[model samples]
Target: MQTIPDELTNIIASKSQKLAYQLRVAWDLNDFLATITFAVVGTSVVSGQDIVKGNAAAVTEWDKYTYENETQYVKKYEFIRETGFPLNSVIKSRASIVLDNTSKRFLPHALPFGTAVEIDDCDVATGWTQSQDGIAPTISTSRKEGTNSLNCGINTAASENTYAQYDKAPSVIDISSIADADKKIALFLYVKDKTKLATANAVEIRIGSDATTNYYRIQIVNSEILQNGWNEIKKAATKVGTPVQTAIDTIRVIFNEATVPASVTLGDLKIDYIRICDSTEEDNYIGSFIRGGRFIKLFSGYNAYSIPQFVGMTDRPKNNIKLAETIINAYDVLHYLETWQMSTGYLLEDHRGDEVIAQVLADAGFTAGQSSLETSMMTIPFTWIKKGQKALDIIRKVCEAENATFYVDEEGIMCFENRYHLSQSPHTSSQYTLDYDEEIIDVGLEPTEVINKAKITAMPREVQASQKIFEKEGASVINAGETLELWAEFQDDYGELPCTAITEPTAGGATSYFKGNTSENGTETDKTNDLSIITWETLGGTVAKMIFTNSGASKVYLTELVIFGTPAKVVKEISYETPDTDAQESIDEFGLKFYELKNDLIQSADYARTLGDTIVYSFKEPKKSLETTIKGLPHLQLEDMVTVNEGSTGETYYMYVAKIEKLAEGYFYKVLLREKVIQSYAIVG
Candidate 1:
């Protein structure tokens, strides 16, 4: 077995080298690594010697690590000369070397256009190769389109293996694209016998590597068909289970007539357009590649990133020694948390039926009752594809809406507690209290400048539902100015027998000129009123109107009061106000800003006001960075609230653990702090 290098094993674990820092800080840096050996949770662990011999495999997690002394953790690391580490902070690491949910390729069910081999219009013998038999195949034009069908003459000599074949060469179609052997494909072709035969063995189709190699044949018994008309035939074939090295090279149509007793000369036959289709309805190429998986290799790498930050947190925490703040890598924090860094997400339907946010977090294996989510159905027709999307995004939305924060505590369980809940909780009962009792090395708060106003603009929700209904209005009558006229309107087609005009009196019936429906060519169906001018003076009538009564199955409504006129346009605007008055004044002071949004996923006013209050509260609790050599709280998590008592005045200040930096070769941890507040009621501005 290969042995580990003496220099690497003897090297001290310190920040003196970049590699050492990674091994100690970002311990779970395998996904971005290459050509290295290690072990992860749920699998076996190997030593540096195993890796050198090329016998080591990849794993998923580095579950636990213990400090060798007060300043060092003697964890084993295997390295190779060709190993590479692309130090990307957000790189994803996998523990095992097995395919999980990644898909690389997909083949569609229906083959694309020109995927099939059509008959050559210029040359009938372009793709086909004649058998070695004495009788050669030729083109038959009895009934032809484009190119005549292929005709293989009878095997006069009664040759056992004589057949006509088509070879798919690499030049014609890129065989590499469809070379997958696991794919099940079907061949379709039209075949007919030129002359009827009394006895024949079978017409068989073969597909595989070559005429003699691994292949399958589908045989059509001669007794199963009549001889004259063209019969469409289809046969299915599957390649071997093991992946093939090359593409399919041959397709053969063997005329197996020699098996018949006293075999007569084979009758002339024709084969038309040959096409290949996926045998299964699904995308065979995608299914084969995805379902048929292989191994995934993971190695060691560095430059790690954290699981996204909490809401209202700064991009970079303020560095102050009093609050325990130090220049620490975010991924180092993730390494300490380990198993507590779990992921969960929910694409809820109607939120009424689904469990509350607390239950969701609990079901996802986090601590129950520590946090809560809003219960109202936020979005209509909510659909989450859920493919590779982080559950943290969902949690972020809830936290932004409900003013909450999530973190894994010292107990190593995910907790979702609102900012208010932590603000009101007793300081003495906190997970960590820094007073005269424990690691209170130094604590100080820094003042931050305040802004007068804050504005949040979001895409407005479409208040109108997706669908609308067209309303019908009552009908109205019209009289040609100062002229005797009869006017009627049918908003929608009733498909009823034509009604006769029953005028108030016989004298009022002024020629009963009617123009109701339009024809296909857009002309009035009955233009009786088109050329006639039946005025009051001409027909001697005070009022001219018609009433209709229909006795038919079809029912319709009157569409308009005045039929021949265009309607006016309608414009609408809706406003959503916040409970905070001072915040609204600031929002309007900047001018009327418009946010044309298409979703109600997040309401803007409350979100903006809450942010404003958080800022105000933040001014009260100054930023502090404490320097401590606290061994017991080595596993402190981000967003964990701890009460800090002043070493001098004994004044209490509750702060959140924003950042942690391990220094002096891991002897001390510098933790950054942020103020926490619980606004029980809505902030006015």
Candidate 2:
């Protein structure tokens, strides 16, 4: 047996179970494999895309393509997704009344009149999904009670609000269980959401498409098909249909309508499930390991055996690459996994997310399996990039146009990055190396984020209360002219108990609650600290406690503390300073003199001091030489030195990244740039 690496062995031997759980999670490479592709998506600002896999419950997340402009350098997100419920290699179906073993229904509302189920757990899926917004299902027991055929739930979109769109995803369903090689059975969907029926949407069951020309287009009605209530709509097999080329195992029931006065909805969809019933529903490929998944890999099979297995089917072992390919291959266009090392160049982990990277491939038109992950020396179409505008301008234009994230890959090819793993940050390499094109394209249209109004609380102002965050899932591409509006309603008592800023300890009534402020600095929300307390005041009751909120992305390290309040400075003590002002010396030399001077200053009679609510002290570099001999100056707190900017002119300054230590997050030490002056710099190792 091969011996484990020393670092692994040492870690295993030293840490207790508790310590092991707290330690940083060692990255497992095989668990993930992908190429930092040059190819992105089809459109600059698109509405949606597709994901196909044999048995893989694949997902896609998207990064909002944004920056100073189309040409400036942008740092995409480099993070992972939060853990969610896992649905392994199982094609669970509950199109009827959803229930637990004991027959207990999951969604009681769906029991009344909707075919409810989380059709897909893809973090990046929408349109006729299992959410309250996507493809929605409704039920009503119109007086036609006894007619057995009418006794069914209707799945339809009657209004624009149902699909959460002026017109995006009208209706869709999981046809993964029905579409097959047989041509006898056609699909039937119920409807009636629109007042007029002349303009109907093409309701068709699609199989597969080959980029263009080779796609299946099906429609419901040419003119008014169903009435106002539940009307049965049928879509028969195409007369020229030749074994519905779509991969039957992972089918997507889709609908498209244009120029229609009213929308269409589906009801009690029943298909020939028996004909396509998969024996075990566990799709095993040709090269999957007989043992656990690690014994064999898919990409290796292509490399060693020259054949590719079906994507999406396997209970992957820990850090197993062979198992990950099933999903990654299927999500090639979606973009959930960041393929770093396994490209045409070599196998690596760190991958970078950027428009420039995708442009290097898709704009040039290179397929993952067709092209070598290790190499991208394309000769055809001549090595050329299609540059459009700047990254920021692209985002603004796309946003204004109601499009998703807009990306500009290498060669100036403007498009949208796939929306595979919407929640996860953009992909990167194992080494955390950044990938960005030096050339940024800006079209000169500047964009700005409007400061949203301060939202008022709705819950009773008592106990701890927080606002509900409105998350935009799968913000994949950038639209050409879209403006996001964050509309919120204000409710006075947004809490059950007293707020943090309190004078009384009571749970209810006028004593505990107080109206919050409406300022941006959180001045009104955190104004409790401004309350006067001259004498010994009890901290137990009605006194409002100050709540400090740090929303800046970078961790802020304290350089010095500054308090603003009514208090007198009894005395001052020099933490560090230089003695002789008219001398010249190097920074190091000045450090020695500064430390010595600090010692003397502390001993001086004018150094007596006491703590107060507010005080200001200046910070300076130790310089008592011809080249730098300057008198010591008072120091400024971190707040006074920098500001977090999310606009045209604001700049973001980093403070430090520390490892868990001393009951903190991790182990670490601060390296001082100037110890005498207390300027500490972080060492990331």
Q: Residue by residue across 105-138, what tens digits does model 1's lDDT show?
A: 1221123222333212212655566553424555
lDDT of each: 0.34, 0.22
Per-candidate clashes, comma-separated: 21, 119
Q: Which residue runs does candidate 1 get wrong by more than 4 Å?
A: 1-394, 407-415, 418-420, 423-431, 435-438, 441-445, 448-452, 460-600, 604-611, 620-631, 635-654, 660-664, 681-685
C-alpha displacement of 145 in model 1, angstroms? 58
Estimate the TM-score of every prediction.
0.31, 0.17
Candidate topping TM-score: 1
Q: In terms of TM-score, how similar is model 1 to the real structure?
A: 0.31
